[model samples]
Target: MTTGAIIFMIIAMVTVWGGLAAAIVNLVRHPEASEAEPSPPVEL
Candidate 1:
């Protein structure tokens, strides 16, 4: 493989892995907010 292709592949792999790590960290650190009560609908 060309040097440029190898570098691009490495960057892509790191980005994906970094994103997954950040997501997992956030999920573990914070309580799920999906169960919170919704505000009453505003009448236009």
Candidate 2:
């Protein structure tokens, strides 16, 4: 593979895994928020 392709692959991998890690941390910090259901819509 080309050097540019390798670099792009590394960047893409980092971005995806970083996002996943952030999501997991947020869920851990706010367990209730992830588990709670949304409220029903109000009647007019």
Q: Evaluate model 1: give its lDDT.
A: 0.94
Every model: Cα RMSD to truth:
3.7, 3.9
Give lDDT per model, in order.
0.94, 0.92
Whole-model lDDT, model 2:
0.92
Candidate 1 weakest lDDT stretch, 10 residues: 31-40
Clashing pairs in 1: none
Which residue ranges in model 2 land beyond 4 Å of their true spot?
A: 38-44
Q: Per-prediction TM-score, please?
A: 0.70, 0.70
Q: Total clashing residue pairs per candidate?
A: 0, 0
**Model 2, 1-44: lDDT tens per residue?**
99999999999999999999999999888787634788889999
What is the clash tally of candidate 1? 0
